[model samples]
Target: MESRKHIRSFVNQTWQLRYGAPVDDATNQIIWSFIVAVLSLGAWAGAVHSGSLPVTYGRKKALLFNNVVAIVAALIMLFSRTAQSFEMILLGRFLYGYNVGLGLSVHLMYLGECSPKKLRGVMTLTGSIFIGFGKVMGQIIGIKELMGTEEMWPYLLAISGVPAVLQFVTLLFFPETPRYLYIDKGDAEGSKKALQWLWQEDNLKLELDDMQKERESTQGEKAKTVKDVLTSRCVRWQLLTLIIPCAGVQLCGINALYFYAFDIFRESGVPEDQMHYLSIGLGATELITVTLCSFLIDRAGRKKLMGYGYLLMGVTMCALTVMLSIKDLNSWVPYVNIALIFCVICIYGLGPSGVSMALPADLFLQAWRPSAYVISGTVNWLCMFLVGMLFGYIVNGLGQFCFLIFVAYTILSAAFLIYFVPETKGKTMIEIMEDFNKLNFKNRAADTEKTDVDLATQF
Candidate 1:
């Protein structure tokens, strides 16, 4: 984002002005990084509550409520200068991050359940595409030619509220997700009407049949909380599926790639002035590839796409490590490293980035879905925080060899997903669960025995 790095000097100047003297520069650096990094921490904080809010308020109302939080954050940043409190900016960023954390998690659930089986993947992946678009727009607007200047920086930061405002207004025109209506609320007629409105068709018999089966499957199951999700063994494999891949999304060095892309390009002997353009090019590549994936997902299937994405990323990292190690010995190899980095980004956008975000919704049913979101969201946010905090240290400590760590991560993640995770692209929710059942439920009789013994011990 423009505010991520470009706003640094401007914000530092404002701090100096507010203090009426020069201050320790390292303190300013730490504070600025904390303000930027705290968003993910706030996201992790909000994730624990993500699923419950949607469950309690219904998806539409929950999002509307989140929009208010975003508005509050924007107002705080807008008035931070007047109050002469840098802490306000930190508070605003945290609240903004919280809003995003909740929005990103629940929006996928809303999209997955609202869409027909055929369009579900694309609909859910639209979130990633939107994010990519936002990143590009932010970068463009944050350029020196635009609002990245000191006087306009506050407006640039405060402008984040615009999307929330628009979403709040536009989402009002949309109806509640049909699955939430039918499955969670048990409103058959209401669900049917929502489906009709959303799909613009009256014949939803086949769609409703899928919801009916899911409802039957969860017929009398009580509501589950975060504690319930953590303690349940029935969802162990499902939990792993949701977690490993989602965490893998970050561990694959996505943030590192973007955060240190300039360094990478510089090391590759790219001209200084052109490096930013090259960086922008990579961002565009991500946006375009993710957009392509959104179209291809239903046809290609999630397991194949995700598996190969990680596979390709692992393979590219292998080459990158070799290139980084050997580039000092040759003149042309830096270009090869640059190309491989681009290749990794392309593959990442194709599968891991969008697919990981959509997986929890596909992997769980109504009864366990909320808990799955909580766990998966927590993993997603935690990994994001870890990556933000530790990546610079890892890069500094390991030098060029640092990529090998990610290579190992990618290879293992790819292997697990290919062999263990099922394809959920065209499958109904019931059918996806059935596929997982075949893999995880093979030893169900033994599991039941273990469950009984454990229950007895508790008494």
Candidate 2:
């Protein structure tokens, strides 16, 4: 335990340097929410638009294309004052949204294929950490007095171009995911070369064996298609398990809080002058908690961390709701609300925030992974949109009762996790499936024996 804690701490520090500042905490709440909502909404718009096109582009091509569009959008936003027009901004947001939806799916698929089975979960979480960091950095920039000027919001929105450029450039240097080269593209020689570049000679044989096993399992099945994802019971169930938790995570109201931190703090009684600094603290704490959770996720197992995290968040929200319901609405009420919000943030960062993003690939076999990712991503964004759109209305309409909705969702999330979600720690993808199969079997004695055997094998 001690060694694990030390390792987690070391990893947290290393990741912090790699990802840089998290999204800013102190930006004006209305603007922050608008930007996030637009970004998320735009991504979906772009996805639906591009998806309608019959382009048969491969993952790499798709990534490049998306980046190109994102760059173009960012440039337009940066240069022309007319770009600030709501309709034009929406157009730009649509393109960015499509890029995000497509890019996220591709990136996860690529990362899953490239990562070793042993480290896949952690690598997956790395992407989430970076995203959290990006959110924090954005919040920081939003709050800066110099940047907070009306002229600067466009620049802040355009800054996403930097990462898009880096991603495009970086792709040129790294080899394509070997599994994609071999399984999807059927370029065996190319796949071998890519694997060699990615892994040491000593590790290549073992890794190749795993890849071969995955390929064989997928061969007889229909090639991964959108149809398969929508139709397959296995794929559908996995998608549901992943999507519900992900949606639940968002509906916990973290994004709304993050997007509206200044407003939330203000409502809670924080002075306008100190809102930005407090927002910064919120971002810092989020970074810290997510960093800690990334290190512990594999060790602690997915189900426990997520279930408990939801429960904690739900409880804190309920407490805040009670405080808000009081007649006085005293200055202390805001402080308590802020404290509860922070607690919710910490729990979320430590568990569902990372795990929900990481688990789809962990649960699905490679053959189904791409489609699985697409479905999960679509559902994730849809829920994000739903929450972003409705949170304010709920808060305004129901007042203190608004929190009960989140509480209900959180409780539902915990129940689903405890009853339905399987533990996926320290097991190979194949082993995870096998364990899942055993648990699903109807014969109690046989299922028990299989479960015991699988658990023994994992250790």
Candidate 3:
């Protein structure tokens, strides 16, 4: 186990550098955000205009078509022959969203399987940093050009392909996830070879043993079927605990504050032009906070940090909401809002934003992991889309009530953590499963006791 941990750590650290080498986190974020923003425009165009491509392609063909859609949209924008319309822009954004949704799920599963218990938290947190950094980068790029400029937006959207291209090339040389090769593909020899590549002359038996244990635990269970997830009470419970809180984490309004930092600044009465520059400060603080949390998460214990972090975020968000509500507030009101925004971002970075993604991947058994992750990822993106689309409307309609929603979510999330979520720190996959199995045993005992008491009363 110790040797496996060491090997996994080395592999994870190496892959982190390799994946980020060509573009780095900031650059990747910039590219991805630009694509998302551009694709948002394309989606709008498709919905509104009659000229766009038909939307009925099959899944495999649709995915390929989507990739082509980005290229085609980019070309249309770049050539500048056709008059720019919201429809064209919307098509690009819709395509980007589809691609991102798929990519995010696959990558999360890949990262979770590749990482060992010791370094899993930091590895997952790194993905979040890249995501936030990408958003900031895209915003900075967008801020440099006029929002409606046809030339810049398409190029920015297309730039995402550069990293995707590089990733495709790099993955060609890298070994597939050993777990995938061993279990899903049923290629024992290939799995051994991949483990050797990952460990590079380290103890291969240790890694194999770890994999064997995982396989045994998951064997004979109908974990692979979607019906298993739906029908099994324990599986259903685990799925809910994993997905609901993760979705709730996003629905708490943090993304609104993060994504629309500039809008928030403008609403707080900061000059519109200056909102972009001030957003850089917000991004910097977020990066710092995420970095700190990544280092501390494995050491501090997931539950303690998450529980405390949510509490802190709730208090800060509530205070900010209250400050925003006061009539004739001091000149520092905007700055206070920014401060509270920073605090909320920081607290979330320390907890939900960084930790929640890692938890479901950790808690679900290996056989059920990919399915659980699919649900979590789907819920995450769905909630994220919901918040991103409706936050402005909510704030406009309900005003301070929006903050109250966030506070309520934070409180409920904290309550969930305190009552049910277990600390995953330093626990192996088997150990974690054993801990959960113990919970099942205890519950069964309680049920039996209750039944006996009822029987005695009847007699």
Candidate 4:
């Protein structure tokens, strides 16, 4: 979807043919924004159901089913230009978004369950690594030498289906996550087999014992509903922990930075023709940072990485605003602004972008996991949709100061994590749950202590 920026002109041309007239700039901007934003709308729709599908079909099968949606969307994109129908593009974008929404949640759930506690943080951040990898691939493929040409744009749009097909074929051979098989389905033998298949190790007594303990703990709880997750007082801090970081991933202005990358690059004296290549460089910076994050997350712990990551990003954004303000003061200032842009992306990829995805999986046990993911995905896509729709106005209204909005948000998110969220690295789900319980019931605990004091005074 990041690739859409390169293909926007081609898409506009296709719509122009459909309109049978010259499309004015204003109308074209609206159409383009709708095309970009519509995917988030579809993702919001798909996220609402992300929880149910995994519970009903199991993670592997649900993900396999989600791939079908992508294939179908791909076919729509493949023929959209031939059909001369912009509506096909919209439909295709929406379906792709839906596929992403479902895939993102379920993929995280599957992997989180599959990972051992020792390697859970590392494995979870791997998902973020690939997400950045995908953006890099998109940028690379969308360059003019490849499919960014007007004649090849439709093929570019449809190319996502190839990976979907690949995953569908490859996923059939792998068993469902062992935790899901054991805890959710109560098939200890099947879970053992899955563990063997996944790990290629027969000495699995400890892993099995852990799952058994978790299963016993969650014996009677069914999968939680979204309402159950939202309204339940017991998990209040868990919900806050999930909600703040997930929402911050979108609200932090990284997407807006990408949306306005060309303008920023142009202002910095990058040639228009070379801007696409610079975009690839931008994507690569995040890819590298996230790859490093995968190594550091377990050692550094989630709270520090995310808390400090946001703090540093806030500082960087402030610097970016200052640089943008002073770009005309010296020729070298624009170059400094460009460097700060890359700095912001690096901080984001290391912290909120990667760690946020792991929170739902870490915070909730099996019964609450699905609903937790649904809320996470909903906040994610909804914020994305809003950013996509409103960022243009933000840029026009606030100009360089637009970054300050994200700066404030990033600082507050950092404070929330530092003050409220606990470190999840090297902790069992039960242990992590206990950590949140203190905060969850802190008020009640305080009340009880106050009553004890009152009773002592009376006595």
* TM-score top scorer: 4
Q: Predict model 4's lDDT versus the native.
A: 0.88
Candidates arranged by TM-score, highest first: 4, 1, 2, 3
lDDT of 2 by residue, 1-459 (tens): 122222233333333454674323342234334645777876665444333221245556667777888898887656534422433554566667777877776666667678776677788888778877886787677764656554465676678889999988987788878876776666778888987887755457766776677777778664466567677655554665777787876787686556545656777666777866777788788888888887888788889999888888888878877876762657676677667778888998998888887876788876667666666676778887888688778778886677788789898888888788778887777777776665445376687889999999999
In model 4, residue pairs whose N, Cα or C atoms come closer than 3 Å (at least 3 residues apart or on different chains), thus clashing, are none
Q: Write the per-residue lDDT of candidate 4 for residues 365-450, one digit (tens) a residue.
A: 89999999899999999988788778878989999899899989999999999987889999888889889989999999999999
C-alpha displacement of 320 in model 1, angstroms? 0.7
TM-score of 1: 0.93
TM-score of each: 0.93, 0.81, 0.77, 0.94
Q: How accurate is candidate 2 locally (lDDT)?
A: 0.70
Question: Model 4 Cα displacement at 283 (Å)?
Answer: 0.5
For model 1, residues 16-78, the per-residue Cα lDDT tens digits are: 887876657787788888997889888876777787888888889988998999999999988
Model 4, which residues run further than 4 Å from truth? Answer: 1-26, 449-459
Regarding lDDT, does 1 or 4 come out ahead? 4
Error of 2 at 95 (Å): 1.4
Q: What is the lDDT ranking, best to worst?
A: 4, 1, 2, 3
lDDT accuracy of residue 16 in candidate 4: 67
lDDT at position 276, candidate 3: 61
Q: Which window of ten consecutive residues has the lowest lDDT sum in model 2?
A: 1-10
Candidate 3, residues 351-434: lDDT per residue as tens digits? 777777677567877677755655665566666656756776887888666778888887887887777766779887777777
What TM-score number comes out for model 3? Answer: 0.77
